[model samples]
Target: MRLLQKNKPVIRFLLTFFGSYLILAFLYNLYLNNASSQKYYPEFITHIVALQSQDLIEAFGYETKSIPSDYDPSMRIAVNGDYVVRIVEGCNAISVMVLFLAFILAFKKDWKSTLLYIFAGLVIIYALNILRIALLTIAIYEYPEYTDLLHTTLFPAFIYGVVFILWFIWIRNFRPKTSPKDV
Candidate 1:
């Protein structure tokens, strides 16, 4: 009891963090599973990514089109029409968003600030993901030999790296502060 009382704040923080994270993760899994039952990929996000990818590719002067894969409607992408790179639900970044949300919530700040930061962060993540997909589509089109390296290494690193930076910023600048006495 003495030990617990001494570390009450830390204990409370951990409980809140892990509890919220698990709940959110479970909810996201439920959403994904439900969507999967209906389609191979979540239509909403994947479709948008496909469309955006196509637009980016076209803007770059590459002939591109986004279409449902012959294998599944849920699977789609902007392709050169020959080397098709399907954008599935996993590529949509919703899971990553959920994780980011969980971390932000765990180290909470003022309600208004928290909400605004979350919104801004989400927007940045989504836009970066779109850019990542666009670049990846071009890379795959131009260098099929580096497909595995691009998809598995470079792009994931970019998104997760950005996410790590965002988390660092949140902790450094946005997380609630404590007085020297409190520490």
Candidate 2:
């Protein structure tokens, strides 16, 4: 009893974090499952991501086209008529956003601030993901030999690194709103 009481804050935080994560993850899964049934659903988010990434690639004077993949339910982003990178549902970044949201909610601050932070962080993450995909496309196009390293390692690391930094910022700034004197 004493031990639990001593660690009440930590326990509460862990429970809240996991509880919210499960709920959000379940809801996201439900959305995906339902979406999978619709003919146009698969292209909805991933296609948009592909289009945005294509736009970024083209901005640098590279010819690119984002189209639906005939082989799979993914968006095929073709660059320079040779290099193609498929953007699947998993590449849309929704799962990572959900994790970020769960953590931010678990350590929520004032309502207005929390909402604003979530919105801003989500925008940053989404934009960064687009950039990551674009960069990966360019790298693969330029050096086909390093496709595995770029896709499997560097890109994932970039997204996770951004998430880690965002989590650190949230934890530092919005730390439960407890009073300094409470310590």
**Each candidate's clash count:** 0, 0
TM-score, candidate number 2: 0.91
lDDT of 1 by residue, 55-86 (tens): 88788888887666667655555455675588
Q: Report the CA-based lDDT of candidate 2 relative to the real structure.
A: 0.86
lDDT of 2 at 165: 99
- Clash pairs, candidate 1, are none
lDDT per residue (tens digit) for residues 1-183 in model 2? 978887777787789789989999998888877666234536467767888999999998899987777788887888888747988989999999999988888788788888999999999999999999999999999999999999999999999999999999988877676666434
Using TM-score as the measure, the top candidate is 2
Clashing pairs in 2: none
